[model samples]
Target: MMQVIYDPLLPWAAIWASAAGVVLIVALALWRRLPGWWLRGLAGAALLAALANPSLQDEAQTPLSDIVVLVVDESASQTLSDRAVQTARAIDEMERAIAGLENTELRVVSLGDAPGDEGTLLMTALSEAVAEEPRGRLAGAVLLTDGRLHDVDRAPDLPAPLHVLLTGHEDDWDRRLVVENAPAFAILDEEVTLTLRIEDQGQAPAGDGLVELDVAVDGGAVRQVRVPVGEDLTLPLTLTHGGTNVIQFTTPAAEGELTDRNNTAVVQINGVRDRLSVLLVSGEPHPGERTWRNLLKSDSSVDLVHFTILRPPEKQDGVPVSELSLIAFPTRELFLDKIDEFDLIIFDRYKRRGILPAIYFDNIRRYVEDGGAVLIAAGPDFASADSIYRTPLGQILPAAPTGRVIERGYLPELAPLGERHPVTAGLPDLAPPGAEGAPGWGRWFRQIDLDPRAGQVVMQGVGDRPLLVLDRVGEGRVALLGSDQAWLWSRGFEGGGPQLELLRRLAHWMMKEPELDEEALTATAEGQRMTVTRRTLADEVGELEITGPDGNVTTAPLQEVAPGRFQAEVTGPEIGLYRLSEGDQSAVIALGPAAPREFEETVASGAALEPVVARGRGGIVRLEDGVPSVRQVREGRPAAGRGWIGVTPRHAYVTSDVTVTPLVPAWLFLVLAAGLSLGAWMREGRR
Candidate 1:
């Protein structure tokens, strides 16, 4: 190709000034009525033109192919119904049409669902594809999706028209249950309200028809209830236990619903105790008296009600009871009236005396049998005939004390069962008094000898006697600590042990915290990865049964990470609720969200991309009718018609080589100017 180019000998500013001078000279000559004024003016114009150089450019060029982006949506929502099939067919037809156009290149970019619970990001994918290609060569962009994009604000500035081939029928619909709001943490035993509603999308059924809902907590017995469709249901939920409570709400599939993936929702509410009321009845004010008190009082969440038996009835100090500073013990109020109000009752070195009657002891036994917790920190009193175990509570007590109490120093060690028990499973070993190179913690000097009759002995003391025994009686839980020197650890006697942590776990376990369950199943999610944990008291665990958001089941064997702690991890391909179970234990953990954002709206629509399409002068055509024919359209013109989608012809090219030559020699311009001047002069002379 040859084109005129220029390498001016003077600056444009100087050239423009010379042209103005020439024009002025011509005007003055014509005003004075000079002979041959037209010829003279033409010569001056040619002189000014010589100063401004012009050249002819010849070049070798290569025509670059025009790029047409075909963005296909393979997101989770598009996989439902016939949208997947429609998308596949559209891609094939668009590819064929683009191939037929000369100098046109097809760029296919497939957009799947975002990681975890994030919805389809079709605009994000489009912006990336545009950035990778040359903007000048972009002929147009075509989207083959259902138009349920979550990142519409990230739409790219298009150089050409943008067209969309919509999938799915207009009549397709879906019924999804939405959990509008739920508290992440709720007070234990308090009612928390959950805002929920069943929504109808597209052509979904609408009416007052009842939708059956099954609500379960930690995979317990499901409570069935019927709620009207499309109405907000404020369901009252109460957390039964502390720690992570999985509350699953599920509704059976409605007739003609698109999919049941959105019909179920899982909510995890962490239950926290408002305040733990502990009634501490101390038999005497010993050195360890402040140990239990400090442990309970240091925790701001615990309300401690401590009472010490300063003087027994058998020991008379010759002081009147009314005049004494000691406050009267409210046995009737504590043992009978408000016993159930206390979460834990700790008897610190408390021996049976004339203070409480046999009926009161029976009442205490009944309290424990009815889901109450008790901790017996025995001392020398446990071996006495007046021990509380000799009363009605003895029937439920885990161990019976011998007639002797050993006062020799002994190192407390974890029993074999304790290695598997949740309470003392991972406790660090402490130095025993002054022995061993490992720097073990403290040791107790007093341990009450006892013979275990029921329950598991988790810790042992001198002569392998039960130091800590945990048992379940009726619906309640109890623990017995055979020594009173737990305070030695608090005093840092030969480097303190894990007394605080041990007591904390013991208290929480007795109170029935779900995480401290001896045998349990739980799951945690981070992005697409899910870590499944199975905690048990046995030597080994079997394979875990995992049910996905869909009804499909997958089994993965649990690997023993620690003693009695088994784990299995799997990365989910999609997002939604998952059911994990092993034998009689089960847990429901939502991998992404209760109701995934992808499934929130399953119907196909072009509303999300309408603004983007309009800005590029493109149109949306439904594939349900037929595949639109591809055609070329001019810039700024509508790129779609009834049955055709248009792609703009960019005519992009690159120059490989070029040569520049002056259009005419400088000498030639001077000769032309002189000839015209002489011709005018001869004509004037002849006239």
Candidate 2:
């Protein structure tokens, strides 16, 4: 290329002044009718031209290839139906067409699913690709995707047009289950409402508009219900336990649906107890009686109804009953009428004294069998003939008193099984075992001798006898503390142990808190990494069987982290639900959102990218129709047509070399001006 440029021999101010003087002289000569006035003006003009030197510049140019960004979506949704095949074909065609163009290049960027539950980030990938190339050389951008991008708000400002080659059929359709609203925590045994809906997108076929929905809790049996589609369904659920409750809802996959990934959804709601109601019945007043009262009363959420047998019917102090200020115990109302309302019933050193009849004891046994918890904190009375074991409640008692009491100072020790039991697993850490110089926890001065009957012995006293036993009776639970000196620890006798913690775990475990279960499987997730935990009383566990979101099954070995706890960490996990099982224990956990953004809508559509494409003056074409021909178009013109897509030709180049040459020599211009001035002078002299 060649262009004329100025390289002034003198300052611009001097050049302009010389030109102005020449113009004024020419005008004066013309007005006075002077001879050869035009010749004198021409000579003056030549001298001014020499001062303003002009040069021609020639440039050697190299054409730079125009960059066309091709972002191919390989996200989860893009694999539905024939969209993957369509994307592959469109990319091949685009590469060839861009290559055939004279000075154009294709920059292919393959995009996958975003981390966590963040679906497809097509716009983010495109923006990054565009930034890698020079804006002046960017001709246009093309996307081969299903158009279900999740990050549309991050679209970049492109210097060229944007085109979309949608990759689904016109008749594509999908049915998805959507959970509109669900609470993260709900009160146990109380009805909580959840809002859900089933939607059909694209060209849905005609049907009865009713689908069967399957609902399950904690991986139990599933219940099916028929509900109408496209309408929100309010489901009322009551949690059974006080911990995480996994509720799964699924609908059968329909025929001709794009994908079934969205047919199932999971919701985890933690169950919490509104309040704890405990019934405390003390046979006689003792030092440990106040300990039970203080422990139960300390928690504001616990409602305690304590009744101590201060005056028995057999005791006659020869004083008038009316003179004694004591409220009579309501045995009938408490043990028969409203026993089910109380969550736990504690018998502290209680013995049969004709107060509660045999019928009341039988009713108490029935209550324990029907999912009610009972704890027996025995004293010397339990080893005597008046022991409650001789009553109907004895059937549910885990141990039988041997009619002996040991009154020697002894430090309680955890049994082997107690080290693995959740109730007593970590109690040893509170006060370490005694050494030669140091005594561990406070010593108990008395222990009731007992023979283990059915339950597991969790603690031992002097002579390796059962000090504490826990058992399961029917659907309920029972605990036996064979000593009444637990309060010694509360007094900080010697060195106190975990007195409060031990009682708290015992209570929660009897109430069937899921976290306190002896055998459990659970999982937690952070991004794509998952930690699987197995808690059991067994010495060891086998490898865990893990079923991923895509129905692929794999095995992971567990390593012992604690006495009874095992764990395994899984990396690079997919976003969705995972089912883990080892032996009879199974657990379901979600690594990301229950309904990932990718599968929320499976049918392909270009509505999300339409506005962006319009702003760039581009068009949306379906790959179902043949791959469009790539053509070169001018900027600010239509960049797409019925059977073809257009890219703007930037024609950008680089100037490798430049040469500058003066238009005329300064010496030649000076000589020409002198000759003209002399000619004009002679003419004037002759006149």
Candidate 3:
């Protein structure tokens, strides 16, 4: 680096000159009275002033051109109509205009759309551009976009002036349909409220204008609701389905409408559940029958239908059918048809009787095979001659009565699997408040002893005999409870049990839902992460294979989270659907939304940023034209007119050489000092 130095004492020479002259005149007037200190002070001031020298130094320097930054907006709004076309035109013209200027260069930046509700972040782009270039070189900036900047407060401490180029037409206008407020979920058959707003921008004035709003569900128009201009309306909507229901509200496209992007809004309302249908059949009503009713009735979602065979065919009464006040059972309707409608089917203390013929028993077997669920609470009849084991269901049922019965009260205990099963798991203890000393639940006097087969043995009663056995037969599932003592769980004879939870899981498992399955594989994804789970007989899976969005394959080992289950997780590099597999089973899942709303809006327009372009002394142009030429103009010069605008440059450098000097030289100072002193002396001599 070049260096320079100078003295700060050049102006003091005049002081000493006056002091010396005073001394000479005073000495001549009062030669004997002159003070020695005054002479010494005067000499010191003059000598010190001459000792400190000031000089000029110079060095060679290479000139640098000024730098100018051109920030062009590329946000989502710019993709509308001819906005993108106009932006391209303006940039070309600006480039040509800036190229022609002397001692100037240009830096161009393009900003695209942001995710979510992010609008134009112009200030962030400008800050980034300024940081990349040398600050000293920055002459100023030219912003080519609409003035609607999302981050307006991020303006920098600029060393140069900033200009804006607006990109919109004078009469640009648009109409948009907005869904103001929507609920995430709504009850079935109940009205849900939704708020909406219809907005018109630019020259679209509010008058007697009527916006025809056509509300639709699943692509069908429900109604054409008329709304006033710039008005907010609240509409009540009712949902029919029980799952995700998509409701679309749109306004009729008016003549000469700017674009249809804002004309339609989609709102999804998930269906709510408040009730469940349950069918309960009893061999005969007993003292504990009320226990089942109370347990089911406690839930708002349960719609229980209870039926009892008061007297079997073995009981003959001397009464005519018309006078007997009893109707023949609709066995075919219950077992053959509409069996799938029931979420749970319970047979309490039930057994084979003449009331239901062999044909109905056969139909019941088919019901289970068709994915229907069945829960059997066996009494003494289960070990007696009236047992239903001899029916066609014998082939799929997981338990067989041993023709033996226990008659003593015993505590109920969960099997190893029952602790994790949703049905039997987490049952409440029967012990009441302040009664912690008592057993949890009531017990039954009798329980049938049954032999376990291929199904899972989840619970045991007296003597460790199988009390509850669950098994899947084809697509259906069956849960056999060897005792009719479930009332004991509610009665708190032993300790309270999870009567409700056990029954719920047993009921749903038979419905073939993947979530309730004991041995199954399922995969779920969010974003690019995928979770692979294996519900198997073993604690850990050997390995899992995954196919990514990019067609890459990877295998992962899984850890056991619980009994008879294994799971693994991996994140893919892409955003889309994915598939996971283990051995013969596979599952497909999605990470992100089916369609990303941000990237889907792909139209290019100029209305969003036209004003920014115009502010930079640049005009809009269409991309149809060939490559435009570059030109340079002076600062504050009109670079863009009908077809183009100019670019500016602010000289920047890593400073190479520097020189500094005083205006006057030491020799000139001394000569001028001597000349004046000589002139004073000559005047004295002439006098």
Candidate 4:
């Protein structure tokens, strides 16, 4: 509703102005003797009315029903180091404080963990709470948390007073360890580097010294390295063996460290190389010559160097040395000079022709003894009296081939123990999803009957003869594939075999891939599910023991996911590195990337809401002690002191216009003037 009032018709001020104009006009007309003086006065009065253009306006406001907003952060980080207990106390105090105020409603909202991202976003929660109710009805806002607000910058600008019920003590502190850089896998026999960073909670001491760093591979102590603290250091790792090398890097806890759980880290580097460097030495050319070369050369990454001894040491071709098509082999260059350059050394069917001096064979034997891989594809000569077995190389050869070549066809199959070896383990099945049927493989038609001197028989031939065997010399690995007819499997001799894939895995495993580790300890993370696997010769292991962010420990049973491997899935209660243990073995698996949102904004400062607080003339009160009461003060006045905070009423007002009148009509005014003048004239005449 609205109303308007004003002096419009015959206003005295307007009337006086009109009369003055008329009087001036009349005086001028009388002096000049002009006509139409009254018409000019009428024109002045008409203009005055248009200039006034007057009206009145007023409004009535429906006062707000006061409401208080309470934002609570219950994210993962809040559960850290006693933050949860503080938050619960603050919320209860706020509920009791707001209950004493009249016409006030309490709205409580709890913020939980955010997926993928970290921390409690106090500002965002407050913004949502302000939006849920009417803006005019907002009384004030209160946030309860450990001051670790990740999205603190997003704090809402509240129209009403805002306060912080800060959680945690100013003296509280914590410490954590960080593994900065860990390679997915390290190359076999090649040095790989890792970086680690250590951090202190609260204020760090001025001086810190060398820390003990231990490297464990497949649960064996390869080395114990001493490294400096604070700065990052590159730790060298030479993957001594192939397959998934579960390398655990650990640093013993210091005297006052908050927790030693984060001091250890477990990383599974999947051992692999784009290509392998193979050196194939052949005493003479044969059908298998192209087979070994083609198999290796087909892969672009595999660098193959093939050498065949066509000229015997004793009998050089009688023709002129220059006339012979074959060039003299540089025995020193291949053996003594750069033996370590190749990953694998293969000796295929060489007799006692002595192309390489006895010293060269001795070096070859030393080569295998010192961290090198050797494969022997024996032929008919392996059974002869003039076999390389008669030379210095006999010491390293796993088996002495019987001077017998069995041309009988037989399906190359794995020995009983081979079924559990990472190379041949889970074979006969292609899909790893399930072990029902891995892959169907073809058969090899020919095999060499050999006598296993000292080696594990991985494959057997007719009459249960050892067809394939493996042995270790010094730190080196050796494999003996008894026959050259392996290519028969590649040609689909018996239902298209996995010969190619099998050979590939066998070679890589011998080279030591961090992926196919037989005895390994590892951890994997995807969302909330974390998988911990322990691969060992032991038939079974106890359930995984997990220590959560809050230092709570629980054990979960592990199920056999594959042969010789035990696995368990742990749904983490909070985001941070979780400690997984069984017996003396423990692994620090990062559950999520960083601290959850609740701990992001760790400082309990009011800078985020200072500007809005000033605009509303409101002050903030900390919740560490207790929440002060809420009381309304004068507009632009303090409601509470620095210890207790609240808002003051603004004393707002609306302007209203007043209309005035003399209780006299236009005709009555004219009559009164005329009668007064007439009476004065009569009295003067009578006098």
Against the unseen true structure, what C-alpha lDDT does each candidate score? 0.87, 0.90, 0.66, 0.67
For model 2, residues 226-338, the per-residue Cα lDDT tens digits are 99999999999999887778899999999999987889889999999999999999988888999999999998888999999887788888987777637778888899999
TM-scores for all candidates: the values are 0.93, 0.95, 0.59, 0.71
Order by TM-score, highest first: 2, 1, 4, 3
lDDT of 4 by residue, 174-243 (tens): 4444667988876666888877765555544455567777777755644777777777777777775554
lDDT of 2 at 355: 91
- Models sorted by lDDT, best on top: 2, 1, 4, 3
* Candidate of highest lDDT: 2
Clashing pairs in 2: none
Name the TM-score of candidate 2. 0.95
In candidate 1, the residue pairs with backbone N, CA or C atoms under 3 Å apart (3 or more residues apart, or in different chains) clash, namely: 430-440, 430-441, 431-440, 431-441
- Residue 632 displacement in candidate 3 (angstroms): 3.6
* Native RMSD of candidate 1 (Å): 2.6
lDDT of 4 at 658: 40
Candidate 4 ranges with C-alpha deviation above 4 Å:
1-65, 76-88, 153-157, 171-276, 315-317, 321-326, 357-359, 430-441, 453-455, 533-558, 561-566, 574-588, 593-618, 633-641, 647-687
True-vs-predicted CA distance for residue 314, candidate 2, Å: 2.5
Q: How far is candidate 2 from the true structure (C-alpha RMSD, Å)?
A: 2.3
